[model samples]
Target chain A: MIETTVFAMQVLLLVMGCLFFAVGTLGLFRFSDTLSRIHALTKVDNLGLGFIVLALLPLAPSLAGGLKTVLIWAAALAASATSAHLIARAVHVRPEPPEAKESADD
Target chain B: MTLILNAVAAFLLLTLLIALIRIWRGPAPADRMLASQLFGTTGVALLLLLAHAQAMPALMDVALTLAVLSVLAIVAFVTRVVRIDRPSSGRKAGDQPETHHD
Candidate 1:
Protein backbone atom coordinates (compact mmCIF):
# COMPACT_ATOMS: atom_id res chain seq x y z
CA MET A 1 0.00 0.00 0.00
CA ILE A 2 2.77 2.43 0.90
CA GLU A 3 4.58 1.75 -2.36
CA THR A 4 1.50 2.51 -4.39
CA THR A 5 0.93 5.65 -2.38
CA VAL A 6 4.44 6.88 -3.04
CA PHE A 7 4.06 6.08 -6.69
CA ALA A 8 0.90 8.11 -6.93
CA MET A 9 2.52 11.05 -5.19
CA GLN A 10 5.44 11.02 -7.58
CA VAL A 11 3.15 10.99 -10.57
CA LEU A 12 1.09 13.83 -9.23
CA LEU A 13 4.09 15.98 -8.42
CA LEU A 14 5.70 15.43 -11.81
CA VAL A 15 2.48 16.25 -13.58
CA MET A 16 2.05 19.40 -11.54
CA GLY A 17 5.59 20.45 -12.36
CA CYS A 18 5.02 20.00 -16.07
CA LEU A 19 1.79 21.97 -15.89
CA PHE A 20 3.53 24.87 -14.20
CA PHE A 21 6.17 24.90 -16.91
CA ALA A 22 3.48 25.01 -19.58
CA VAL A 23 1.76 27.89 -17.83
CA GLY A 24 5.01 29.78 -17.63
CA THR A 25 5.44 29.44 -21.37
CA LEU A 26 1.84 30.42 -21.96
CA GLY A 27 2.50 33.65 -20.11
CA LEU A 28 5.05 34.52 -22.74
CA PHE A 29 2.36 34.35 -25.39
CA ARG A 30 -0.40 36.01 -23.35
CA PHE A 31 1.50 38.84 -21.69
CA SER A 32 2.25 41.82 -23.91
CA ASP A 33 5.23 43.19 -22.00
CA THR A 34 8.74 41.98 -21.25
CA LEU A 35 8.64 42.57 -17.50
CA SER A 36 5.41 40.66 -17.14
CA ARG A 37 6.81 37.81 -19.18
CA ILE A 38 9.88 37.66 -16.95
CA HIS A 39 7.64 37.67 -13.92
CA ALA A 40 5.78 34.65 -15.18
CA LEU A 41 8.82 32.68 -16.37
CA THR A 42 10.90 33.21 -13.25
CA LYS A 43 8.22 32.65 -10.64
CA VAL A 44 6.36 29.81 -12.30
CA ASP A 45 9.40 27.93 -13.62
CA ASN A 46 11.01 28.12 -10.18
CA LEU A 47 8.04 26.36 -8.67
CA GLY A 48 7.88 23.86 -11.47
CA LEU A 49 11.51 22.80 -11.16
CA GLY A 50 11.29 22.74 -7.40
CA PHE A 51 8.46 20.26 -7.59
CA ILE A 52 10.38 18.04 -9.97
CA VAL A 53 13.41 18.14 -7.75
CA LEU A 54 11.37 17.22 -4.73
CA ALA A 55 9.78 14.35 -6.58
CA LEU A 56 13.12 12.96 -7.61
CA LEU A 57 14.72 13.10 -4.18
CA PRO A 58 13.13 9.89 -2.95
CA LEU A 59 14.59 8.08 -5.89
CA ALA A 60 18.11 9.33 -5.40
CA PRO A 61 20.68 6.60 -4.93
CA SER A 62 22.39 8.15 -1.93
CA LEU A 63 22.18 11.05 0.47
CA ALA A 64 24.90 12.88 -1.40
CA GLY A 65 23.13 12.33 -4.67
CA GLY A 66 19.93 13.73 -3.25
CA LEU A 67 21.66 16.80 -1.93
CA LYS A 68 23.27 17.31 -5.33
CA THR A 69 19.87 17.33 -6.93
CA VAL A 70 18.67 19.94 -4.47
CA LEU A 71 21.77 21.96 -5.19
CA ILE A 72 20.89 21.99 -8.87
CA TRP A 73 17.48 23.38 -8.01
CA ALA A 74 18.96 26.06 -5.78
CA ALA A 75 21.44 27.10 -8.43
CA ALA A 76 18.67 27.36 -11.00
CA LEU A 77 16.58 29.52 -8.69
CA ALA A 78 19.46 31.91 -8.19
CA ALA A 79 20.20 32.13 -11.90
CA SER A 80 16.59 32.77 -12.80
CA ALA A 81 16.07 35.46 -10.18
CA THR A 82 19.33 37.24 -10.91
CA SER A 83 18.88 37.25 -14.67
CA ALA A 84 15.30 38.39 -14.39
CA HIS A 85 16.33 41.33 -12.23
CA LEU A 86 19.12 42.31 -14.60
CA ILE A 87 16.79 42.21 -17.60
CA ALA A 88 14.15 44.23 -15.81
CA ARG A 89 16.68 46.85 -14.72
CA ALA A 90 18.01 47.11 -18.24
CA VAL A 91 14.51 47.62 -19.59
CA HIS A 92 13.74 50.24 -16.96
CA VAL A 93 16.87 52.24 -17.65
CA ARG A 94 16.02 52.59 -21.31
CA PRO A 95 12.55 51.67 -22.38
CA GLU A 96 12.34 50.73 -26.02
CA PRO A 97 9.34 50.38 -28.26
CA PRO A 98 8.98 46.76 -29.26
CA GLU A 99 10.24 46.17 -32.76
CA ALA A 100 7.16 44.35 -34.03
CA LYS A 101 4.25 45.43 -31.91
CA GLU A 102 0.69 45.11 -33.14
CA SER A 103 -1.91 47.86 -33.00
CA ALA A 104 -3.71 48.01 -29.65
CA ASP A 105 -6.87 49.44 -31.14
CA ASP A 106 -8.07 46.15 -32.53
CA MET B 1 8.55 5.24 -12.96
CA THR B 2 10.70 5.64 -16.03
CA LEU B 3 7.67 5.90 -18.22
CA ILE B 4 6.15 8.63 -16.09
CA LEU B 5 9.39 10.55 -16.04
CA ASN B 6 9.67 10.30 -19.79
CA ALA B 7 6.17 11.67 -20.21
CA VAL B 8 6.92 14.61 -17.92
CA ALA B 9 10.12 15.31 -19.80
CA ALA B 10 8.23 15.28 -23.05
CA PHE B 11 5.75 17.83 -21.73
CA LEU B 12 8.58 20.07 -20.61
CA LEU B 13 9.98 19.77 -24.10
CA LEU B 14 6.67 21.00 -25.44
CA THR B 15 6.87 23.95 -23.11
CA LEU B 16 10.32 24.62 -24.48
CA LEU B 17 9.01 24.63 -28.03
CA ILE B 18 6.37 27.19 -27.12
CA ALA B 19 8.99 29.39 -25.50
CA LEU B 20 11.11 29.12 -28.65
CA ILE B 21 8.23 30.64 -30.54
CA ARG B 22 8.44 33.73 -28.36
CA ILE B 23 12.16 34.02 -28.96
CA TRP B 24 11.65 33.71 -32.69
CA ARG B 25 8.84 36.27 -32.81
CA GLY B 26 10.43 38.61 -30.32
CA PRO B 27 8.93 42.07 -30.46
CA ALA B 28 11.82 43.21 -28.24
CA PRO B 29 15.26 42.12 -27.30
CA ALA B 30 14.27 41.87 -23.67
CA ASP B 31 11.48 39.54 -24.70
CA ARG B 32 13.97 37.29 -26.40
CA MET B 33 16.29 37.40 -23.43
CA LEU B 34 13.49 36.44 -21.06
CA ALA B 35 12.54 33.55 -23.30
CA SER B 36 16.13 32.37 -23.34
CA GLN B 37 16.12 32.40 -19.56
CA LEU B 38 13.05 30.22 -19.68
CA PHE B 39 14.90 27.88 -21.99
CA GLY B 40 17.76 27.64 -19.54
CA THR B 41 15.44 26.70 -16.72
CA THR B 42 13.68 24.15 -18.87
CA GLY B 43 16.96 22.65 -19.93
CA VAL B 44 18.04 22.19 -16.34
CA ALA B 45 14.77 20.56 -15.45
CA LEU B 46 15.02 18.26 -18.42
CA LEU B 47 18.52 17.30 -17.42
CA LEU B 48 17.39 16.43 -13.95
CA LEU B 49 14.59 14.31 -15.31
CA LEU B 50 16.99 12.61 -17.67
CA ALA B 51 19.32 11.80 -14.82
CA HIS B 52 16.55 10.01 -13.01
CA ALA B 53 15.16 8.28 -16.05
CA GLN B 54 18.46 7.02 -17.36
CA ALA B 55 20.11 6.42 -13.99
CA MET B 56 23.01 8.54 -15.09
CA PRO B 57 24.25 10.65 -12.22
CA ALA B 58 26.71 12.60 -14.36
CA LEU B 59 23.86 14.37 -16.09
CA MET B 60 23.22 16.19 -12.83
CA ASP B 61 26.63 17.77 -13.14
CA VAL B 62 25.74 19.07 -16.57
CA ALA B 63 22.56 20.48 -15.13
CA LEU B 64 24.54 22.21 -12.41
CA THR B 65 26.83 23.83 -14.94
CA LEU B 66 23.87 24.96 -16.99
CA ALA B 67 22.10 26.49 -14.02
CA VAL B 68 25.17 28.40 -12.86
CA LEU B 69 26.24 29.74 -16.21
CA SER B 70 22.89 30.58 -17.74
CA VAL B 71 22.83 33.92 -15.94
CA LEU B 72 26.12 34.92 -17.50
CA ALA B 73 24.50 35.18 -20.92
CA ILE B 74 21.93 37.63 -19.63
CA VAL B 75 24.56 39.65 -17.82
CA ALA B 76 26.51 39.92 -21.04
CA PHE B 77 23.40 41.02 -22.89
CA VAL B 78 22.69 43.73 -20.33
CA THR B 79 26.21 45.10 -20.40
CA ARG B 80 26.61 44.92 -24.16
CA VAL B 81 23.19 45.77 -25.56
CA VAL B 82 21.63 47.95 -22.87
CA ARG B 83 24.65 50.17 -22.26
CA ILE B 84 25.59 50.76 -25.88
CA ASP B 85 23.54 53.95 -26.13
CA ARG B 86 26.23 56.04 -24.41
CA PRO B 87 30.01 56.16 -24.54
CA SER B 88 31.64 53.40 -22.49
CA SER B 89 34.26 55.67 -20.95
CA GLY B 90 32.80 55.15 -17.46
CA ARG B 91 30.97 58.50 -17.44
CA LYS B 92 27.75 59.83 -18.90
CA ALA B 93 27.54 63.39 -20.14
CA GLY B 94 26.43 65.86 -17.42
CA ASP B 95 26.92 63.22 -14.72
CA GLN B 96 29.02 65.65 -12.71
CA PRO B 97 28.27 69.24 -11.83
CA GLU B 98 30.20 71.74 -13.89
CA THR B 99 32.75 74.06 -12.21
CA HIS B 100 34.40 77.12 -13.75
CA HIS B 101 37.95 76.44 -14.89
CA ASP B 102 40.55 78.40 -12.92
Candidate 2:
Protein backbone atom coordinates (compact mmCIF):
# COMPACT_ATOMS: atom_id res chain seq x y z
CA MET A 1 0.00 0.00 0.00
CA ILE A 2 2.78 2.41 0.89
CA GLU A 3 4.62 1.69 -2.32
CA THR A 4 1.49 2.25 -4.34
CA THR A 5 0.85 5.55 -2.61
CA VAL A 6 4.37 6.70 -3.29
CA PHE A 7 3.94 5.80 -6.92
CA ALA A 8 0.76 7.82 -7.06
CA MET A 9 2.48 10.83 -5.58
CA GLN A 10 5.34 10.49 -8.01
CA VAL A 11 2.96 10.46 -10.94
CA LEU A 12 1.27 13.59 -9.68
CA LEU A 13 4.54 15.43 -9.30
CA LEU A 14 5.76 14.43 -12.72
CA VAL A 15 2.57 15.77 -14.27
CA MET A 16 2.83 19.01 -12.35
CA GLY A 17 6.43 19.50 -13.40
CA CYS A 18 5.58 18.94 -17.04
CA LEU A 19 2.62 21.29 -16.79
CA PHE A 20 4.67 24.18 -15.43
CA PHE A 21 7.26 23.60 -18.10
CA ALA A 22 4.53 23.86 -20.72
CA VAL A 23 3.29 27.07 -19.15
CA GLY A 24 6.77 28.54 -19.35
CA THR A 25 6.88 27.74 -23.04
CA LEU A 26 3.50 29.40 -23.38
CA GLY A 27 4.98 32.51 -21.81
CA LEU A 28 7.71 32.44 -24.38
CA PHE A 29 5.06 32.48 -27.09
CA ARG A 30 2.58 34.95 -25.62
CA PHE A 31 4.79 37.48 -23.82
CA SER A 32 5.41 40.56 -25.95
CA ASP A 33 9.07 41.03 -25.14
CA THR A 34 12.28 39.23 -24.29
CA LEU A 35 12.51 40.44 -20.69
CA SER A 36 9.09 39.17 -19.73
CA ARG A 37 9.86 35.88 -21.41
CA ILE A 38 13.05 35.62 -19.39
CA HIS A 39 11.06 36.08 -16.20
CA ALA A 40 8.74 33.29 -17.20
CA LEU A 41 11.47 30.83 -18.22
CA THR A 42 13.36 31.22 -14.94
CA LYS A 43 10.26 30.45 -12.90
CA VAL A 44 9.57 27.32 -14.93
CA ASP A 45 13.16 26.17 -14.70
CA ASN A 46 13.10 26.55 -10.93
CA LEU A 47 9.64 25.31 -10.01
CA GLY A 48 9.09 22.75 -12.74
CA LEU A 49 12.47 21.15 -12.21
CA GLY A 50 11.95 21.18 -8.46
CA PHE A 51 8.75 19.23 -8.71
CA ILE A 52 10.27 16.71 -11.09
CA VAL A 53 13.21 16.22 -8.76
CA LEU A 54 10.90 15.65 -5.83
CA ALA A 55 9.03 13.04 -7.80
CA LEU A 56 12.16 11.24 -8.87
CA LEU A 57 13.64 10.96 -5.39
CA PRO A 58 11.64 7.87 -4.57
CA LEU A 59 13.19 6.05 -7.48
CA ALA A 60 16.77 6.62 -6.39
CA PRO A 61 18.64 3.39 -5.70
CA SER A 62 20.35 4.69 -2.58
CA LEU A 63 20.82 7.75 -0.40
CA ALA A 64 23.78 8.86 -2.47
CA GLY A 65 21.79 8.54 -5.62
CA GLY A 66 19.09 10.72 -4.16
CA LEU A 67 21.62 13.31 -3.00
CA LYS A 68 23.17 13.39 -6.45
CA THR A 69 19.77 14.00 -8.02
CA VAL A 70 19.03 16.84 -5.62
CA LEU A 71 22.46 18.26 -6.32
CA ILE A 72 21.59 18.32 -10.02
CA TRP A 73 18.53 20.38 -9.22
CA ALA A 74 20.60 22.83 -7.15
CA ALA A 75 23.16 23.11 -9.90
CA ALA A 76 20.46 23.65 -12.50
CA LEU A 77 18.76 26.34 -10.46
CA ALA A 78 22.07 28.12 -9.94
CA ALA A 79 22.95 27.91 -13.59
CA SER A 80 19.53 29.09 -14.71
CA ALA A 81 19.58 32.07 -12.38
CA THR A 82 23.08 33.07 -13.38
CA SER A 83 22.36 32.73 -17.09
CA ALA A 84 19.10 34.66 -16.90
CA HIS A 85 20.92 37.51 -15.19
CA LEU A 86 23.67 37.50 -17.79
CA ILE A 87 21.20 37.51 -20.68
CA ALA A 88 19.08 40.26 -19.19
CA ARG A 89 22.19 42.35 -18.52
CA ALA A 90 23.34 41.79 -22.05
CA VAL A 91 19.98 42.89 -23.38
CA HIS A 92 20.11 46.00 -21.25
CA VAL A 93 23.72 46.83 -22.06
CA ARG A 94 23.13 46.43 -25.75
CA PRO A 95 19.60 47.14 -26.65
CA GLU A 96 18.60 45.57 -29.95
CA PRO A 97 19.31 47.55 -33.11
CA PRO A 98 17.34 50.80 -33.24
CA GLU A 99 15.57 49.83 -36.41
CA ALA A 100 14.34 46.50 -35.04
CA LYS A 101 10.63 46.45 -34.16
CA GLU A 102 10.90 44.27 -31.02
CA SER A 103 13.59 46.45 -29.44
CA ALA A 104 10.87 49.07 -29.19
CA ASP A 105 9.92 47.29 -25.98
CA ASP A 106 12.85 49.14 -24.47
CA MET B 1 5.59 3.32 -13.61
CA THR B 2 8.02 3.02 -16.48
CA LEU B 3 5.15 3.57 -18.83
CA ILE B 4 4.14 6.72 -17.05
CA LEU B 5 7.72 7.94 -16.98
CA ASN B 6 8.04 7.40 -20.70
CA ALA B 7 4.78 9.22 -21.27
CA VAL B 8 5.85 12.19 -19.21
CA ALA B 9 9.19 12.29 -20.94
CA ALA B 10 7.41 12.33 -24.26
CA PHE B 11 5.21 15.17 -23.07
CA LEU B 12 8.29 17.18 -22.11
CA LEU B 13 9.76 16.54 -25.53
CA LEU B 14 6.57 17.75 -27.15
CA THR B 15 6.79 20.98 -25.23
CA LEU B 16 10.40 21.31 -26.29
CA LEU B 17 9.40 21.06 -29.93
CA ILE B 18 6.80 23.75 -29.33
CA ALA B 19 9.45 26.01 -27.82
CA LEU B 20 11.50 25.55 -30.97
CA ILE B 21 8.87 27.58 -32.78
CA ARG B 22 9.73 30.54 -30.53
CA ILE B 23 13.36 30.15 -31.37
CA TRP B 24 12.46 30.27 -35.01
CA ARG B 25 10.33 33.39 -34.68
CA GLY B 26 12.72 35.36 -32.46
CA PRO B 27 12.59 39.06 -33.28
CA ALA B 28 15.43 39.81 -30.86
CA PRO B 29 18.66 38.02 -30.15
CA ALA B 30 17.84 37.66 -26.46
CA ASP B 31 14.60 35.92 -27.27
CA ARG B 32 16.49 33.29 -29.19
CA MET B 33 18.88 32.84 -26.28
CA LEU B 34 16.00 32.60 -23.81
CA ALA B 35 14.51 29.76 -25.84
CA SER B 36 17.91 28.15 -25.83
CA GLN B 37 17.87 28.27 -22.06
CA LEU B 38 14.48 26.61 -22.11
CA PHE B 39 15.98 23.78 -24.13
CA GLY B 40 18.69 23.32 -21.53
CA THR B 41 16.33 23.10 -18.59
CA THR B 42 13.87 20.82 -20.33
CA GLY B 43 16.69 18.63 -21.57
CA VAL B 44 17.87 18.13 -18.01
CA ALA B 45 14.44 17.00 -16.93
CA LEU B 46 14.16 14.65 -19.89
CA LEU B 47 17.49 13.02 -19.14
CA LEU B 48 16.52 12.47 -15.55
CA LEU B 49 13.34 10.73 -16.55
CA LEU B 50 15.02 8.61 -19.14
CA ALA B 51 17.69 7.59 -16.63
CA HIS B 52 15.01 5.92 -14.57
CA ALA B 53 13.09 4.50 -17.46
CA GLN B 54 16.18 2.82 -18.78
CA ALA B 55 17.52 1.90 -15.34
CA MET B 56 20.80 3.52 -16.15
CA PRO B 57 21.90 5.65 -13.23
CA ALA B 58 24.80 7.06 -15.21
CA LEU B 59 22.38 9.26 -17.11
CA MET B 60 22.07 11.24 -13.90
CA ASP B 61 25.60 12.43 -14.42
CA VAL B 62 24.73 13.42 -17.95
CA ALA B 63 21.84 15.47 -16.64
CA LEU B 64 24.14 17.19 -14.16
CA THR B 65 26.63 17.99 -16.85
CA LEU B 66 23.86 19.39 -19.03
CA ALA B 67 22.64 21.48 -16.11
CA VAL B 68 26.09 23.01 -15.79
CA LEU B 69 26.57 23.51 -19.51
CA SER B 70 23.27 25.26 -20.17
CA VAL B 71 24.47 28.31 -18.26
CA LEU B 72 27.47 28.54 -20.53
CA ALA B 73 25.24 29.12 -23.54
CA ILE B 74 23.75 32.25 -21.99
CA VAL B 75 27.11 33.41 -20.68
CA ALA B 76 28.56 33.23 -24.15
CA PHE B 77 25.59 35.02 -25.62
CA VAL B 78 25.95 37.87 -23.10
CA THR B 79 29.72 38.22 -23.34
CA ARG B 80 29.45 38.09 -27.09
CA VAL B 81 27.15 41.09 -27.00
CA VAL B 82 29.19 42.98 -24.38
CA ARG B 83 32.47 42.45 -26.26
CA ILE B 84 31.11 43.91 -29.46
CA ASP B 85 29.22 46.76 -27.82
CA ARG B 86 31.87 48.11 -25.42
CA PRO B 87 33.32 50.89 -27.59
CA SER B 88 29.92 52.07 -28.72
CA SER B 89 28.57 51.89 -25.18
CA GLY B 90 31.25 54.35 -24.14
CA ARG B 91 30.01 56.72 -26.84
CA LYS B 92 26.35 56.23 -25.99
CA ALA B 93 27.06 56.85 -22.31
CA GLY B 94 26.62 60.54 -22.67
CA ASP B 95 23.28 60.40 -24.46
CA GLN B 96 21.64 57.90 -22.04
CA PRO B 97 23.82 57.09 -19.04
CA GLU B 98 21.59 54.55 -17.34
CA THR B 99 24.33 52.11 -16.35
CA HIS B 100 25.23 53.67 -13.00
CA HIS B 101 21.63 54.43 -12.12
CA ASP B 102 20.95 50.75 -11.61
Candidate 3:
Protein backbone atom coordinates (compact mmCIF):
# COMPACT_ATOMS: atom_id res chain seq x y z
CA MET A 1 0.00 0.00 0.00
CA ILE A 2 1.02 3.64 -0.32
CA GLU A 3 1.26 3.94 3.45
CA THR A 4 3.75 1.11 3.58
CA THR A 5 5.87 2.79 0.94
CA VAL A 6 5.82 6.05 2.86
CA PHE A 7 6.87 4.22 5.99
CA ALA A 8 9.78 2.65 4.19
CA MET A 9 10.83 6.04 2.85
CA GLN A 10 10.72 7.49 6.34
CA VAL A 11 12.93 4.73 7.65
CA LEU A 12 15.37 5.24 4.81
CA LEU A 13 15.48 8.98 5.42
CA LEU A 14 16.08 8.47 9.11
CA VAL A 15 18.99 6.13 8.51
CA MET A 16 20.50 8.48 5.95
CA GLY A 17 20.14 11.37 8.35
CA CYS A 18 22.07 9.51 11.01
CA LEU A 19 24.76 8.72 8.48
CA PHE A 20 25.10 12.41 7.64
CA PHE A 21 25.38 13.24 11.30
CA ALA A 22 28.16 10.73 11.71
CA VAL A 23 29.96 12.15 8.70
CA GLY A 24 29.71 15.65 10.12
CA THR A 25 31.21 14.49 13.38
CA LEU A 26 33.91 12.69 11.47
CA GLY A 27 35.08 16.07 10.17
CA LEU A 28 36.09 17.07 13.65
CA PHE A 29 38.53 14.21 13.86
CA ARG A 30 39.84 14.39 10.30
CA PHE A 31 40.31 18.11 9.90
CA SER A 32 43.14 19.79 11.79
CA ASP A 33 42.03 23.36 11.26
CA THR A 34 39.20 24.87 13.25
CA LEU A 35 37.50 26.55 10.32
CA SER A 36 37.65 23.41 8.20
CA ARG A 37 36.04 21.49 11.02
CA ILE A 38 33.33 24.13 11.33
CA HIS A 39 32.73 23.87 7.60
CA ALA A 40 31.96 20.20 7.97
CA LEU A 41 29.99 20.45 11.20
CA THR A 42 27.65 23.28 10.23
CA LYS A 43 26.77 22.39 6.64
CA VAL A 44 26.60 18.63 6.85
CA ASP A 45 24.83 18.43 10.20
CA ASN A 46 22.06 20.75 9.03
CA LEU A 47 21.52 18.47 6.04
CA GLY A 48 21.39 15.55 8.45
CA LEU A 49 18.84 17.27 10.67
CA GLY A 50 16.79 18.12 7.60
CA PHE A 51 16.67 14.48 6.63
CA ILE A 52 15.65 13.39 10.11
CA VAL A 53 12.93 16.02 10.32
CA LEU A 54 11.58 14.89 6.98
CA ALA A 55 11.46 11.33 8.22
CA LEU A 56 9.56 12.31 11.37
CA LEU A 57 6.94 14.49 9.68
CA PRO A 58 4.67 11.56 8.88
CA LEU A 59 4.64 10.49 12.49
CA ALA A 60 3.55 13.83 13.85
CA PRO A 61 0.54 13.61 16.19
CA SER A 62 -1.38 16.38 14.48
CA LEU A 63 -1.09 19.24 12.03
CA ALA A 64 0.15 21.48 14.79
CA GLY A 65 2.73 18.94 15.85
CA GLY A 66 3.97 18.61 12.28
CA LEU A 67 4.29 22.34 11.89
CA LYS A 68 6.22 22.55 15.12
CA THR A 69 8.52 19.81 13.88
CA VAL A 70 9.19 21.82 10.76
CA LEU A 71 9.69 24.89 12.86
CA ILE A 72 12.39 23.12 14.86
CA TRP A 73 14.20 22.38 11.63
CA ALA A 74 13.88 25.99 10.51
CA ALA A 75 15.16 27.25 13.84
CA ALA A 76 18.09 24.86 13.81
CA LEU A 77 18.97 25.82 10.26
CA ALA A 78 18.92 29.50 11.13
CA ALA A 79 21.02 28.91 14.21
CA SER A 80 23.59 26.89 12.32
CA ALA A 81 23.83 29.41 9.49
CA THR A 82 24.12 32.36 11.84
CA SER A 83 26.58 30.65 14.17
CA ALA A 84 28.71 29.41 11.31
CA HIS A 85 29.02 32.94 9.99
CA LEU A 86 29.65 34.32 13.44
CA ILE A 87 32.30 31.73 14.22
CA ALA A 88 33.89 32.27 10.86
CA ARG A 89 33.83 36.00 11.44
CA ALA A 90 35.34 35.56 14.84
CA VAL A 91 38.12 33.52 13.33
CA HIS A 92 38.62 36.17 10.67
CA VAL A 93 38.90 38.90 13.27
CA ARG A 94 41.48 36.95 15.15
CA PRO A 95 43.52 34.36 13.38
CA GLU A 96 44.67 33.08 16.73
CA PRO A 97 42.11 32.60 19.48
CA PRO A 98 43.17 32.63 23.10
CA GLU A 99 41.89 29.40 24.49
CA ALA A 100 44.05 29.32 27.60
CA LYS A 101 43.06 32.63 29.08
CA GLU A 102 39.41 31.71 29.49
CA SER A 103 37.74 29.47 32.06
CA ALA A 104 35.02 28.40 29.67
CA ASP A 105 37.27 25.85 28.04
CA ASP A 106 38.04 24.24 31.35
CA MET B 1 9.37 2.56 13.26
CA THR B 2 9.79 3.37 16.91
CA LEU B 3 12.62 0.88 17.12
CA ILE B 4 14.37 2.51 14.20
CA LEU B 5 13.99 5.94 15.73
CA ASN B 6 15.56 4.74 18.95
CA ALA B 7 18.42 3.16 17.04
CA VAL B 8 19.02 6.37 15.10
CA ALA B 9 19.04 8.31 18.31
CA ALA B 10 21.65 5.98 19.73
CA PHE B 11 23.74 6.51 16.63
CA LEU B 12 23.64 10.29 17.19
CA LEU B 13 25.01 9.81 20.69
CA LEU B 14 27.97 8.00 19.20
CA THR B 15 28.62 11.03 17.03
CA LEU B 16 28.56 13.15 20.15
CA LEU B 17 31.24 10.97 21.63
CA ILE B 18 33.43 11.68 18.63
CA ALA B 19 32.87 15.42 19.03
CA LEU B 20 34.01 15.13 22.62
CA ILE B 21 37.33 13.85 21.38
CA ARG B 22 37.62 16.94 19.24
CA ILE B 23 37.07 19.07 22.29
CA TRP B 24 39.70 17.22 24.25
CA ARG B 25 42.25 17.77 21.50
CA GLY B 26 41.45 21.31 20.45
CA PRO B 27 44.34 23.68 19.76
CA ALA B 28 42.16 26.76 19.27
CA PRO B 29 39.23 28.40 21.00
CA ALA B 30 37.06 28.08 17.91
CA ASP B 31 37.78 24.39 17.72
CA ARG B 32 36.49 23.83 21.21
CA MET B 33 33.47 26.06 20.60
CA LEU B 34 32.76 24.17 17.39
CA ALA B 35 32.71 20.92 19.32
CA SER B 36 30.14 22.38 21.71
CA GLN B 37 28.09 23.52 18.73
CA LEU B 38 28.07 19.97 17.49
CA PHE B 39 26.88 18.92 20.90
CA GLY B 40 24.01 21.38 20.81
CA THR B 41 22.89 20.34 17.35
CA THR B 42 23.27 16.62 17.91
CA GLY B 43 21.37 17.00 21.13
CA VAL B 44 18.51 18.65 19.24
CA ALA B 45 18.24 15.80 16.75
CA LEU B 46 18.42 13.25 19.52
CA LEU B 47 15.62 14.98 21.42
CA LEU B 48 13.42 15.01 18.34
CA LEU B 49 14.01 11.33 17.75
CA LEU B 50 13.12 10.53 21.33
CA ALA B 51 10.04 12.72 21.25
CA HIS B 52 8.71 10.64 18.40
CA ALA B 53 9.90 7.27 19.61
CA GLN B 54 8.58 7.80 23.13
CA ALA B 55 5.40 9.63 22.08
CA MET B 56 6.25 12.73 24.03
CA PRO B 57 5.32 16.04 22.45
CA ALA B 58 6.97 18.30 24.98
CA LEU B 59 10.46 17.31 23.81
CA MET B 60 9.95 19.38 20.70
CA ASP B 61 9.86 22.50 22.78
CA VAL B 62 13.02 21.33 24.47
CA ALA B 63 14.70 20.93 21.09
CA LEU B 64 13.69 24.43 20.05
CA THR B 65 15.06 25.81 23.26
CA LEU B 66 18.29 23.91 22.79
CA ALA B 67 18.70 25.40 19.31
CA VAL B 68 18.26 28.94 20.62
CA LEU B 69 20.65 28.36 23.50
CA SER B 70 23.28 26.88 21.20
CA VAL B 71 23.29 29.94 18.99
CA LEU B 72 23.44 32.15 22.02
CA ALA B 73 26.45 30.18 23.21
CA ILE B 74 28.21 30.93 19.93
CA VAL B 75 27.34 34.60 20.24
CA ALA B 76 28.79 34.62 23.74
CA PHE B 77 32.02 33.12 22.51
CA VAL B 78 32.26 35.79 19.85
CA THR B 79 31.48 38.71 22.10
CA ARG B 80 33.12 37.58 25.31
CA VAL B 81 35.73 34.99 24.46
CA VAL B 82 36.96 35.78 20.99
CA ARG B 83 36.09 39.39 21.65
CA ILE B 84 35.00 40.29 18.12
CA ASP B 85 35.37 43.99 18.73
CA ARG B 86 39.12 43.88 19.29
CA PRO B 87 40.38 43.55 15.71
CA SER B 88 39.27 47.03 14.71
CA SER B 89 40.98 48.67 17.64
CA GLY B 90 43.96 46.48 18.53
CA ARG B 91 45.92 46.75 15.31
CA LYS B 92 48.31 49.54 14.33
CA ALA B 93 47.63 51.70 11.28
CA GLY B 94 48.73 50.23 7.93
CA ASP B 95 49.49 46.91 9.60
CA GLN B 96 47.85 44.04 7.71
CA PRO B 97 46.08 46.58 5.50
CA GLU B 98 43.38 44.15 4.51
CA THR B 99 42.18 43.48 8.10
CA HIS B 100 41.50 46.78 9.82
CA HIS B 101 38.28 47.68 8.02
CA ASP B 102 34.93 46.87 9.63
Which is the leading candidate under TM-score? 3
**Candidate 2 structure quality by residue, lDDT tens digits, B68-92:** 8888877776656444345654565
> Any idea what lDDT model 3 has?
0.84
Instruction: Itemize residue pairs with steric clashes in candidate 3.
Output: none
Better of 1 and 3 by TM-score: 3
Candidate 1: segments with Cα more than 4 A from true spot? A97-106, B84-102
Candidates' C-alpha lDDT: 0.82, 0.81, 0.84
Grade the docking of candidate 3: medium
**lDDT by residue for model 3 (B1-102), tens:** 888999999999988887788787767777778865785678889999999899888899999999988989998888888878566556776664233346
Q: Compared to the true structure, candidate 1 yields what TM-score?
A: 0.86
Quality of model 1 by C-alpha lDDT = 0.82
Model 2 global lDDT (CA atoms, 0 to 1): 0.81
**Per-residue alpha-carbon lDDT of candidate 1 for residues A1-106, written as tens digits (9 for 90 to 100):** 9989888888889988998998998888888888888899999989999889988988999999989888888889989988888888778776783343323311
Could you tell me which residue pairs clash in candidate 2?
none
How high is the lDDT of residue A65 in model 1?
91
Superposed model 3: Cα runs more than 4 Å off: A99-105, B89-102
Please provide, for model 1 over B1-102, each residue's C-alpha lDDT reduced to its tens digit, 9 standing for 90 to 100: 998898888889988987898777876677777765875689999999999898888899999988877888887877766663454445666675233378
